[model samples]
Target: MVTTKRNKEFCQKVRLKSTQVFIVAGTCLITVLVTLLCIGFMTRYEVDNEVANVADVDYWKDKVASSQKIWYDKGIDELNEALRTPRGPIYPKNLRIFLIQGVDGRDLAAYRFSGKDLSNGNTNFVWDKFPHFARLKNTCSQQFPCPISSVAKSLWTGIPLDKIPEAQPDCGNLVNETETPFSVLRQAQLAGLLTGFVTTQRFTGSTGAALGNTNSNYECDERMPLGSLKSGCQDIARQLITGETGKSLNVIIGGGRQMLSSLVPKSISDPVDELLCESNDGRNLLKEWRNQKLKESKVKPIKFELVQRADELESLNASNFDFLFGVMANGDLSGNSNAPSLKLMVEKSLQVLKKKNQGYLLIVEQFIQSGMNKRKELQLLNETLTNLKREEDTLTLVLLTNAIYPKPILDMSEETETINQLSETFNEAEFQIQETLYQMPSESLLFAIGPKSSIFHGVQKETFIAHAVSHVLSKSSPKT
Candidate 1:
């Protein structure tokens, strides 16, 4: 499920997430600024359109090649050092963020999905067992009804979206790392937690969410780089794996094997790119990961493994390796027939992350499918949640939909027709909305289950998610 009907509408309604912040060698980066450090980001360099083309696959194949141009003037080591701070002493055992993206209030009404005290209209399955539900008022702001990108930024750095310079119309490129001084993930990592961010949704860039969508402030210790199919310029996979930041991610999964599998096509529109999607750049990163393990370090070393299929991922002994890198497709996994199920990915990631005693932060992005399948997914999730051990150390929060309905699809459907009919005809385009309100929608669903979850109540902006994580990290601090 790439996007809900709302997501498809967002494609037309929202353009900010896709707005370019920085385009170096066709590689996109967002410039987030905290102090005056971001003053001259725009003037720093001009990407020669011709030079940006991926012609010299030989030169581009070098791991350092993509980031070399930008890292030179910026001082990569200094930037990474500045970004890396000491973590706290108290590490939460389990903290997971299950973000079901692009799901609107109307989508909830598509069928009868309920939890504990939550339920919409008449329905077949009663999700009465799901627990700790709540909602956020207006998604982000007045201008943009869909504030996935804006909310993501605020949620990451604790800075309101409008306050971001990178968010400006022309300075959109700045929406990336240029202005970001810190992020929830960075803070968590500093606190010594193993972190991984996996998203079924392709690339959102700055336009998606602040640190959540992109590698802004090193959102995840590792990622499942589900790269885009765009040619010429390198996709996100190349930029991140080879980013000049120097902070290493432990595991990356998902699709877009095209980007990392081989050389990016010289022409952005090269037709043969398909055959060569998984092109060999000569630098096999999986082998590189194994090579990385050969060199012993002063600190504890990370073990590595690379697998291509779901069974292979499941078969691995989680304790045997620290860094796991694998790809399942040539592009996004949302609707891919061959890609492993999201359920499998989440379960596998959790299986591996649970091995670490320090605890972890897993960010899972799921595009909700409407109607029965959607409700079933919710049911499956609830069943999964029911099985988890929720102690003081665990915090499983699901940021479900909170928007008001657009004309109410259920209302438009004939009274005699079952919920199934309305769902079958559903298309995200027709449900697009523009106006905004913050009050939690009457039929909304948000769950804050497990240990510390009860602390959240009433209305909230999604940024509160970060605040909660921050509070835990502070306790982890040795000074505390």
Candidate 2:
């Protein structure tokens, strides 16, 4: 009996020791797991904070400003309307309008002059007119003249403004055929809506060439020179505007009249008034297009018209032509502020293009939004124009509001003081002081309005605009 009791006690002790060991081991395992989990959570938090910080930097601030303006001004309303409105898949036969070439979209958001305001004896501000920088009291100081070029470069690349190339120094031979914009245009042409190119720059300039045939060289080809290099503008006007392209172009309009005159010009002293006498090339261009139309009786004949003034454009019969060209100015058409309004241009183009039951593609550009002030104007203009298009079955797309302007940050103290000052000073200020206090950072903005604008918002590359246009056009085409 004594031996049995001793053995049982020994066994009990052994069991106690093992239990303690197990408990200690389990606690250690739990501790390790908790530590690992804490570390992972901390890492994720840090990463998220870093991302937010980067977004707050100058570049993203500009983007946010421009994008928010569109959203606040018209995008949201347009989106709601689109969602509520029933849409038939875009018909291939509908006319296509394009706005390209030049700095556009900066001040487009600010051009919000209401008709009621205009009519109500409030001439405090002109709604559609471009505002000069000198008129802005809040304009940046001399120390920081608005960085227009820097902003333009940044917007084009979607990078920080400082990172953009200062100049495009001759990057060797330009393999123009391979550029993405040209490829997009080629695809557009192949899809079958009548193709047209209009611009204020040389036909060979980056934007202009994107629409026309690609060449290994940038200079107008040997076939089309009038005077010297300085005089090449005339050559561009005559040759490309009226010159033969193997393909039947539905429309061609823009400046560069001096380029069209030949060595044989005699009577007209004013180079602008000189008529493009029928050169072999001009006759051939006309003959070839005529023959093509005759051969394919189903196709519409290409009608050509040169418009120097807005009044001239207004007089044309909308029903008469399938193709129309108007060169409004000698050089780049007047900046949006100084030039005839884009509203006017859009109206005229639509009139001509819509005449065809078969549909048409028209590209209209307002090329003055390169600077900060102009960008703001472009933005406002876009909003106004978009509102105007409410009744039409149109899709308007805006590209590259991406230019980066220097950050305009008002610290919390300044913002508070400004608000207080405004409240005390103005008895009946219609505009909110806070709205003016929170100035936009200069950044590029891109958006699309009309039927399918929602497809574009958020961050995207420039080429995507080209892709979207093609995709939209393709969906709308008759073959599809």
Candidate 3:
């Protein structure tokens, strides 16, 4: 009887232990499964956040669907046809082009630099200095009073703002390859000719953007809406680094350094700008530009320089470098002593471009406000023109894109006199301006020299300028 009791107790203990072991194993397995499920949820949440940041396709689809028909110039249809014509294969050697902007006939006459009064029905100003230059007329200003329209009209496409349909806000001033031809700078680049863009305006401004960028509604990346960015519409500054024409440029000198860098930990040498340089997209474009150049250098030896200060620009020996990029300010060049003058920029550009044997196309724009600033720019322009080598193979075009402002009080500060004595005649003279609103259309002028310049005579449509340039460029046989 005692033996039987002991065996039963032992069996009971064994059963109890077996139950505990099964419970522990099941609990452990359940815990492991729950942990794996939690990990999966966390990974899914991270992916969801990323997609949410860019917004869902349905969200963007609604935005695009709601977008109304944007208005543009009526002549765009015809201009598109003209642009669609295939470019010629020929690229002539020793054919150089210089397109200079902001040489207003009215301003020239008002300042008495032309020795003739253009306001007094005197068409003689066109023939006074350079007999070959044509005084082209821009009729788009008669309709749209904005300087923006003037640039849009004279640009590669030569089409003005919307006129046919009711004008809409935030319309016009956009370029697309489907509607317009390649810019002169792009054409020159494709032709294997050196190309440069020098401006006192922001490098991504309408004038500068027109040289290389296409289809961008905004000049900077931050200004673009998420919908626009997602739709593959790149901003102007981004295009400058990635675009075919922009990357191939031999020389680029102007302002807008902040556009190429991040907002935080501002780039070295970036000036404090009135507008914030908010590139919240987490991209450092300046670094990207450098990386691109470095990668290209691996394939072929290329000497390039990226400078920021006036002293750095001045110190550069133009012939030693194949590419030069100088961003002197955050905005349009300020009167900061650290910034190089327009004349200095032009001088350096000419020197660098002239080194190429195939020829070059240099476009220089002086977009400045204030009478004093205009005077200083004009003085520098005059000096540069006077110093030009006047090569027979070079075609120089001075286009007066008049962006009029209210006449300011002509105050002569001692600081102004320090520029040089060459501006003395222009300083003491009384400055006169036609009283008009800021956007009102004013007469524009064009001066030309070199081959085929005689063909441009009398007043012509703004579109005629692009056509004429194309014609001249096409006349040459392909480079051997």
Candidate 4:
């Protein structure tokens, strides 16, 4: 009986020790959690403070203005120098063109990879493919690195967004229609060269619209003010269909079918279609464009094809169609399985444009976001460049916008709201959207290859590109 009692006491002691251990562990866990919470709270506080201090809208605006002034002076000097340079005898009729946008310094730096082979087992860098390509320092707009502004300046010499004082300062509004200068594509069209436009963005997006539009208040009909429409302003899509430069285009391929169509009833096959059919106007711009071509066909032997599917695009015999229009998506291209790839579009465009013996100019605009996808895009671009280089007469120009949004104001707290209100008085919201927290202006790069590529070898203003093209094409002898 005494031994049994001793065993029970020992068991009680063991239970007591286990209870004490549990309590001690619980205390340690609680203490650790509290410490973590404190650290997180402190970090968040520091971040908030940094954001508040750095996101001073007034300071940002002042810095932009000062920097713009410096660029403007430099641009003026470069423009004058280009004007003074001897005009080269470039054969316009023999020259085929590929003007590419959406490359940046990061892309070029990737080429330097310490002479190492890429993970994809490619030993040659993209630049190595075109050893003759000249690397030039390209500048963005003197005022802002807006996509529309940069494009306008690149297409029409000496004209940037800030220079157009008459047009309302907005991304959707390009040059004043009355004051609009002839674009490089327009010049090529007038010179009897077949022209084409290809993009991964909306067909009516800023880059595409700047090619042909003027005094445009919005990209789509739904986005335009009724007053503006009544005042004889047309949306970008309408401009592309009806405008002189736009109509003369031999090839038009990209996305943004929703902007062209009115309430296209979504079918079961396209249940996940992201295109919202946002047009309230009772007109289908695509049909209108087709009808216009059809009417012309009745008068002449004009062959045209309009397609909405990637498969349809693939099946098309580009040589059979004098004009090709393909809207591969409802909105901006998502590079999905069904959408036509950038390289595919370029190949098709090349086929269509090459048919015209008078020569051709193709504007390929791609908007690449930052990160790993950018690398993939660079690879695709290299493939396209290879195809372009196959034509000995083709001159390909790659334009890059580095950090398109420079020093973006990230914080939009109460303090920022107050700054925005103050800035609204000075039209800051016009160029820089009040709600946008990212994107800042930065330097860009220019790469060129083929005949007369020497003209763009040095650091020059963005306008110099158009100036050089104008000089070469206008002064050159026509092909026999």
Judging by lDDT against the true structure, name the best candidate. Answer: 4
Model 4 TM-score on a 0 to 1 scale: 0.65
Candidate 4 structure quality by residue, lDDT tens digits, 291-361: 99988889998989998888898888887778999888777676334778888898888778776456777
The lDDT of each candidate is 0.50, 0.44, 0.63, 0.64
For TM-score, the strongest prediction is 4
Q: lDDT score, residue 256, model 1?
A: 47
Clashing pairs in 3: 145-439
For residue 360, give model 4's deviation from the true position in Å.
0.8
**Residues 1-480, candidate 3, lDDT per residue (tens digit)?**
999999999999999999999999999999999999998887698677542222221223334433331212223433343333223223233344334455465566555444444433433232245545565544443332334523543555445333212212232334444544477677667666788888877788776666774546466767787766665666778888888878899899998766776553334445556564445576666777778888989999998888878988898898787888888877667534467887789888887887644677788877755555555566667777777776656666777766542222234322233334435534453432112222234446777755566676887766677777766655532366
lDDT of 1 by residue, 1-480 (tens): 755877988886556545543244235223344324554443243242222212222322355666575544345433343333223323446678777655655555564545554422333322232335566544342333343445556666766656643322222334455555456766766676666666654422331234433333212212323232221233334445544311344455665445554432232222222422343445445445455556533356666677766678777775566766656554555435555667667766766666534667666766553442666665655555555555556666776653233321323322223234445435434433111122223323566655555556776765666777688666643332
On the 0 to 100 scale, the lDDT of residue 8 in model 1 is 81
Error of 3 at 445 (Å): 0.3
Alpha-carbon RMSD to native, per candidate = 30.3, 16.6, 28.2, 27.0
Off by over 4 Å in 4: 1-102, 111-123, 128-157, 165-179, 265-277, 335-337, 407-441, 475-480
Ordering by lDDT: 4, 3, 1, 2
In TM-score terms, candidate 2 sits at 0.48
The TM-score values for the models, in the order shown, are 0.55, 0.48, 0.64, 0.65
Candidate 2 Cα misplacement greater than 4 A, ranges: 1-86, 90-183, 198-205, 216-247, 262-302, 335-341, 355-357, 369-393, 400-443
RMSD of 4: 27.0
lDDT of 3 at 426: 45
lDDT of 2 by residue, 165-272 (tens): 332223333334244223344455567655555543433444444344332222232444333333333222233433333144565555433333223222222233
